[model samples]
Target: MKNTIFIALILLAGILTSCGSVKYFGIETFTPAEITFPETVETVVIVNNAVPQPKKPGYKYTIMGVEQDTTHMVADSALYDACKALGEAIADQPFFKDVRLYNDAVRQDEFFFQDTKLTPDQVETICDESGAEAIISLDRLLFNMEKDVFPFGEVMAGTIKVQATAVLRAYMPGRNNSMATIYLTDSLFWSEGASNLRTLDSYLPKPEVALRETAAYLTSGAYRNFVPHWEQAQRWYYTNSGTRWKQASAFAAKEKWEEALTIWQSIYEAQTNKKSKAEAAANIAVGYEMVGKFNEALDWAKKSLALFKEQTSDEKDSNVALLTLYEQVITSRIQANNKLNMQFGKE
Candidate 1:
């Protein structure tokens, strides 16, 4: 089934107005993945091929600016956590028909080397055994842990940071080369300030917990390249003081876009001031966005931007900035829509 293509408007509380009368709402936008796979590969298998952190010496971890012999920092479960996260993320998408997780480590002996590749025969065997069209191999997962503590006057502040790097590859049965190779690095940080050192220490996550969390974060982003995802974005509409503007805002608050759009059209037609007309046009563009009319939204947003520039004679005006931002948002959505169509096999 085609994913529902409609903007979801959410009203923000407390601080509603910006630029005197411009109020903003939240809208959900779909962003396309960085890579688009062929539609023929519908089922995917996620495998862990990375070796776990060894218990032997030579790997040092720095915490609080001191090297510590810590047993909890050994990341025995890092590969498992990363592979599980990738599988879960892929399963969340409706684009793939099935997702399988291979629990065993395919390359347990490979720890220092990074240039390893799965042979074509191995890819075929894995796909055949898992009943999947392609394989997503978690090739390598490595981490570096660091912590810093400082004293400021009477307070103690500490920060714990974990750096993770992961390499992943995609392979089909007959392909000699990987369909995609994703090499990503990510960092997770936790900072807390307390009256005492003990309190600050209690606020940070344990070493074991931090290891798993960092592993998950490293691989979770790889799923974005395989599927389209929704991102929350802010969009503003003008509600300057007026009965008609207030009425339209009320209707828009209820998600009645057509009703609000009707009033905004009337206001644009009758308003003499360029600023007022620009406000109405901007609101109309948001209404069109709510109804999934992106082309129309882009058109009205351009008109509103032009009007704002004409009214202020300066591009630095707040209203001009607002319209400029909205124009960029609409343009991005239009581009994402095109990529989404290709990913969904509509193109």
Candidate 2:
């Protein structure tokens, strides 16, 4: 009886092992799913007419003091430092590429100390000689200093305001001309605490930041305005009727269905006469046919034909093109409907 019990246990263990093996072999496994990155799109800067010059090494500038006085001598260092700082700040901008700031070499001479007025032509000539695109001409009217205390009595502060104007003229080497002239009048405000006073230094970084931002804004605006083919299509269409009609015909010939349709829609909206509206509608229908929108095309074509038939006078010559377009739309729509019926096994 013990042998018989042992035999039954052995058979049960073998069956369980086979079942485990079968289950292990039956299950399927796979590697984790893979992911893909999007394609990189290149940024295109369109430059037509005169190509913008490659941003070169830093530009050199001559900073000249346009005024002279006893008080001006006392404030000379501060004024010079301020102009140099402003030049550095502008050059640091991304658009500037590179720049160098320098004090005017001809100092306290006839041109520098006298009541000299530098005209635009004179400034341009200076720019040409210096190999610089811009110049910083300083004329200081007033530099005043004042003192105040903090509310909590933590520190005393001294403030200085420098009133002046800066002119930026960009040169177009390719065109052999200077483009737009920019003028910025700024009141430079500076403040210093007791510690800053001890250091003999105090100027707000805010003013410099604001100045750089303003320059960047002006430069971008100028570049955009200078671009030749950047005007809107709608504006072009409104200004030149012949050009607009030619564009409409060209778009239709190229099978640019949507563009052609848009041009015709504009014409229809602008037309006051029934004949012009009918003609526009007929052309619009032909555009729709090119886009495979047969029903819409057929509708517009029928409307155009009805208008042509209802005209009081025989203006057949005026509508010859429109009539031809209408017939083409009707024929195409019929063929398309027949094709659709056959596709669905209805005919």
Using lDDT, give the best candidate's number.
1
Off by over 4 Å in 2: 1-241, 313-332, 344-347
lDDT of 1 by residue, 1-347 (tens): 01221121222211336335767766677888877778888888998877776543324445456766754466768778888898898789777899899866677573534647788988998988889988889877777777677776788887778888878888888888988888989989988889887888798777768889999988886888777887766666788779999999999988999999999999999999998998899899999999999999999999998988887667766677666766777887898889899988999
How many clashes does each candidate structure show, in the order listed? Answer: 0, 2
Against the unseen true structure, what C-alpha lDDT does each candidate score? 0.79, 0.41
Cα lDDT for residue 271, candidate 1: 95
Task: Report the C-alpha lDDT of model 2 over 1-347, residue by residue, as the tens digit.
Answer: 32333343234334434544100011111111011101121111111111111112111111122221211213333334444544544443333333444435322332222322335564555556655554433322122222222322555454444343333333322334334444445444555665443432344333334333333332333322211112111000111245666688677656576997898889878977777677677777666765767678788777776776677456443343335434553554466455444433456
In model 1, which range of ten residues has the least summed lDDT? 1-10
- The TM-score, computed over Cα atoms with residue i paired to residue i, of candidate 2 is 0.27
lDDT of prediction 1:
0.79
Q: What does candidate 1 score on TM?
A: 0.81
lDDT (C-alpha) at residue 179 in model 1:
81
